[model samples]
Target: MILERHGLGWAGLAIGLIAPFFIATPYALNLMTTAAIFVMLAVGLNIVVGYCGLLDLGYAAFFAVGAYTSGILSTELGLPLIATVPAVLVVTVLAGLVIGGPTLRLRSDYLAIVTLGFGEIIRIVATNLDITGGPSGIFGIPGLFGDALSGPVALYYMVVVTAAIAVVLAARLGRSRLGRAWRFIREDEDAAEASGVRTYRVKMAAYVAGAVWGGLAGVLFAAQLSAISPAGFTFLHSALVLMAVVLGGMGSTPGVVLGAVVISLLPEALRGLADGRYFVFGILLIVMMLIRPQGLWPYRSREHGTSTPQEAREPERARMEGTL
Candidate 1:
């Protein structure tokens, strides 16, 4: 399974590298770049929603925080775009703590509601603040590679590389010790706690990880657009990202990436349908859910010969009774 996954990863990287050579149109590059950023966002949210089972409706707040932070520093402080990354990381971590600290305690619908409210609060705050340009948003931001490598092709390659790295890192996290703790909480929080897992801290770590991912994606977004407005980071944005994660198999990294690409590019592919495209898209989503509610690529355990707790304990009990 690991070898197959690595093979697929290599194939994907080859395709991304060669795509520009085949379809080098500016519009196509821009669209592909946007889709890559969306992949990052969906993968990030997967850490919180898919891995830790935390439904975060305010995930876009971290995206906004990252974009605005990078935009403000670059435009106001006259810092280069790359220089703002450290600051973006710092602000996003703080934003995660501020929002996740209080809300991670709640479960299910309550947690979702609070997160939705927090997402709105962040948007409203950005809209009203003069520093954020009072809904006009920041403009004339610097390029990702500055004046040295400033074309659409350069930007596209840079974004693809960054997104690929993000996906790999997220996948690695999913296989780490921390990732196991998250899955434990997701499977059964009470059981995890009983087993000595620090549920709150584990959830917090997931939230922070997701926040950092979203924030980095935002920086990429800001670099791509060269400007941003409050209107860009709406609840709709968060919903679309969540949809990608759901449509792609929540805990399956490859599935999430494929889902994100499909969600991001499908509408564009349906442009010929005109205004009815959205209606068609909606119907398609409904059909898809009904057909494969588990997701496009539902997560499956790769570990072979693994036994359930009951099965493992049975051997111990038999041994205790000299029945082994």
Candidate 2:
């Protein structure tokens, strides 16, 4: 099963590598790059919402934190885009601790409401801050690869590689012992606590992991646009990321990636409909929910020590022969 999964991943990577050959247009590359970044965001959120069962409605806050941190550092200090990653990581980790430390204690609706508020606060602060360039946002941010290979195609390839790595890492984490702890908490926090799992610490770890992923994606976003703005990190943005996780099947890595790609590209694919595209999109989403409430790719656990159908039937057959 692991080999099969890895084969699928390699196949996906091969497709991404050759995509430019078929549709090398700048617009196409830019859109594909954005979709890849969305995939990263969705996967990150999956760690919190999918694996850990934390309902976070303000995930975009971390994204903003990373983007603003990287943008401000690069634009103001004249640092290269790559150099700001360490700072972005630090700031995002702090943001996770500060936010998750207090909020993780609350469950369900309360946690969601608080996270929503935090997302709004981050956006408002960015709008009001001079360093963030107020409503206009920070502009002229540096590119990811600098002048070494400064082209849309090169940037697209770079973003794809980074997104791919993020997905793989998240998948690996989901299979680790820490991941099992997360699932335990998700299914029943009280039970997880009784099992000697430190639920609080485990939850915090998931939040911090998710925040780091979002932050890194933010750096890519800033590099792609060469700008960072309050408008980009809104409540709607957070909702969309959450939607991708839900629609893709929470806890299912491939599902989340597929969900993100569909969400990101569907609108553009419907450009012919123009003004009515969103309306149609809404209808499609509604239809999808009705058809597959479980999600496009729901996660299924592989149970240990489960008897095969044939094996079970053999026992039944023996019993029947003895009775006869």
Candidate 3:
């Protein structure tokens, strides 16, 4: 089964590599590229919400921080966008720690509320800060790849490679020991704690990891658009990312990718529906929730132990009777 899954992943990567050859227009390429970036965001959020089971509504704050970090470094310091990646990574991780350290202690709705407030706070601060260009945000940002490979087609390929790596990394992380810890916490925090897992630390790690991914996506966003505003990192952006993870299948990498692609492309595909497009979209989402709540590609757990409660209990009972 694992081998089959690996083969499927490689095949998907192969198709993505050749996708541009079939696309005819720059607009189409742009849309595809955007979808790829969005996929990264969804994958990142999946670490926190899907794998770790922490609800984060302020994910876009990390995205904005990355974009702004790269934007500032590139425009003001005369650094290349590629050169700013290290700083972006550092800043994002710190941002995650700053927010997650205090807020992860809260459970359920309270955590969500705090995250939501943090997201708005980041946007508002960006809007008022001069370094972020106030309300206008940053512009004249350099490309990730220089003149050697700066065309739309080239950038589209670049984004495709980055997104593929991000997804693969998320999937790999989900299978690691740390990933198992995240699953434990997600399933039951109290049980996870009793099992010797440092629940707070594990949750923080997931949040930081998600922040890194979101920030990297932001770097791509800045490079793609060469400009960003507070408007780009709003609550709606965070909600959409959450929706992608939920709609796809939380903790399922391929499902999250499919969900992100659908969410990104569906609106464009439904543009011809005129004024009824959104209505149709809503209905489709509702239908999907009703019929396939687990998601289009739900995660399939590999571990299957045969020990049943009765079977295990029989041995204990026999041992007790013998002792008596």
Candidate 4:
């Protein structure tokens, strides 16, 4: 049964990989490209928030760092988007360490607040710094592979490849020993530490991993838009990604990806809503929260678990793994 499911999943992925070949309209292609970027961000956050049980309200900070890094470098230095990948990884890691080092020691509410503050700091610094071009942001950013590979079709594939890489890396990480440590920490931090798990380092690893992927997604964002600004990275943007992780079922990769796609495409889908859409959206969110607080696609029950009365009432274990 497992192999059958895997085969079907991979087959579906193959078809989705070729989806852009059939999508000829620039508008449709652009929408899909944006969705891919959203998926990348959600997946990256999954590492920290979903798997590790950390509450990061400022994940957009890493995302902004990545996009700005590539945007500034490519536009000001005559560098290619591909050339900015390493820097994005490095800068984001440093940013994660600088931020995570100070706050990972705190429990939930504190961590969340600190991360939220970190996010605002990144944006405020960008707004005040000339290197980030202030409010105008860095425009005319270059794409990967230059103009020869700058067509919509090329970009679609480029983003698809990058998102695919992130998904694979995240999945692989989740299956490793470190991943298990993260899970342990999430389930019970004190117990994890008692069991000889270095909770601090494990949490830091999750944070850094998330930062790296988030940063890479930023590079793709810069290449796709070829322009960026403070407006692009906002509190609402961070909240939306968090909503995707939650609504899609925190910790499940497939669920989170689906959440990312829906969250990204929702505004376009609601174009007919016009001025009333946001109002309706709030209503729907309230309804959904009441009806399915676990999210749109929730984690599956474990196959071999004992259903102790208390355990039965407990929340389901995350089948996939992502940050909420």
Candidate 5:
């Protein structure tokens, strides 16, 4: 378990270090950067969907909030993107708390509906509000690290660094005590509460954390686009982000990253596949689902102090276990 958990981090670091050398094409570099950003989104959502087993249908609302907050502040107020980080955090957390607090008491479809409505509310507000520039959206939002480091390549590096940090923080949190609480809630909320876990609070925490994560990804998105609008934060966007988490193998960091990369880049890569490519792609997705319903790399369970699966009692083996 230790090796399984740490191995992905080591591999990610190694890949990030070495990828720049092989990927010189600007298009390819952009794809990688976008993948990293989506990976951040997936990791954050994993906290809710993977660990906590919450069906968050509106994750992208937080992302839009972060993006819009940074875009508006940076353009209208003449602040740098860096200055907008705190606002992004505050808005996302409050949004999460407000949305999650009430709906979390409800289960399944009911909770999903409230979250979905919250998503639409965010998008519509951005569309109708003058401060959000209405449908025209904000433009010329500043880039990261100021003008001195605003080159496309330089911004790519910035993304690589920050995205890495986000990924690390999320994975660490997932392995912590709270993560266990989330899992317990996911599996059986009442049982977890009976066992002294505060199901309501933990669920709220998970929702807030996931919201913060989606919001951070939005900040990065704003930095990348240097613009914001209601058009950009749509229901499809939320579905895509959620799809990445699901297809990637919930609760598995590496699998989520792989899933994000594949989902984000597949369209670009499929440019050569012609008009019917989507047909093939859809077929492929179906095959993947049929084969790996749990995920491409499912989180495994084990007995203590052993690397193998716990099996049914084998009387003969137990008797010979006197070798202990």
Candidate 6:
């Protein structure tokens, strides 16, 4: 399964890398670039929601953190946007800990509510901050490259390559020891704890990882648009990221990527009927959910040996009993 998945991923990457050759229009490039950025966000959020079973309604807060941090640093210090990436990472990781450390203890709907509030708080704070340019936000930012004319095209390719690498890395993480721990916690936190997994620590790690991914995406966003405001990072953005995860098959990498592309491009595709685009979008989401709530690419866990928990633990329990 893993090998097959990788093969498909590589094929997709190849297609993405060469897609510009076939469709070089500016509109096409812009749409593809946007979809790639959206894919990064969805993949990151999947680590929280899919891998760790954490409902993070405020995932966009981390996105905001990265964007604002990078924007402030670059604009204030006369630094290049790329130069602020390290600072962005540090800020995002800290933000994750600050938020996840306290709130990850909550379960299900409670966690969702708190995250929702956190998302709102980040947006509101950005809205009021003078450095963030208040409601008007920041503009006149430099592009990723020195040349403005070629910057968009270069950035588009950069985003595609980066997104492809990120997807592969995320998949690799999902197959690692830490990934297994996340699955255990997702399956049953109590069981994972009983098995000696540090549930809180593991959850925090997932949250932080997700934050880093989101923050990086934000940096790309700031570079691409060369401007940003509080309005760009809102509950709606968080909800859409979550929707991509759910719509794509939460734990499935390929699924989430597909879902992000669909969500990002569906509106553009429907723009011909400007008045009814949103309505059509809503109907499509409803139909997809109703028809395949599990998602377009549901996760399929590998087969495990059929050893009962008690049987697997019997030797340890017996040894401990004898020692006692």
Which residue window of length 10 is worst by lDDT in model 4? 307-316
Best by TM-score: 1
Error of 2 at 241 (Å): 0.6
Clashing pairs in 3: none
TM-score of each: 0.93, 0.92, 0.92, 0.90, 0.89, 0.91
Q: Estimate the lDDT of model 4.
A: 0.80
- Which residue pairs show backbone clashes in model 5? none
Taking the tens digit of each residue's C-alpha lDDT, what string does model 1 give over 1-324? 121266787798789888999994789989999999999999999999988889988888999999999999999977768889999999999999999999999999999999999999999999999999988999999887577677888888888999888998898898677876777777678767766777899999999999999999999999999999999999999999999999988777888888899999999999999999999998998899899887887665555322232222333223323310
lDDT of 2 by residue, 1-324 (tens): 121275776887799889999995789889999999999999999999998899999999999999999999998898878889999999999999999999999999999999999999999999998888999999898787566666888888989999998998999898777877777677667766765777899999999999999999999999999988899999999999999999988887887888999999998999999899999998999899899887887765533322222232333233323332
**What is the Å distance of residue 205 in model 5 from its true position?**
0.6
List CA RMSD, all candidates.
4.6, 6.9, 5.5, 4.2, 5.5, 4.6
TM-score for candidate 5? 0.89
Model 5 residue 149 CA deviation (Å) reads 0.9
lDDT values, one for every candidate: 0.86, 0.86, 0.86, 0.80, 0.77, 0.83
Segments in model 2 whose C-alpha atoms lie over 4 Å from true places: 1-6, 304-324
What's the TM for model 1? Answer: 0.93
* Candidate 4: clashing pairs of residues: 46-322, 46-323, 49-323, 50-322, 50-323, 50-324, 251-321, 251-322
Candidate achieving higher TM-score, 3 or 4: 3
For model 5, residues 101-144, the per-residue Cα lDDT tens digits are 88899899988888888899999989999998998998898886
Total clashing pairs in model 3: 0
Clashing pairs in 2: none
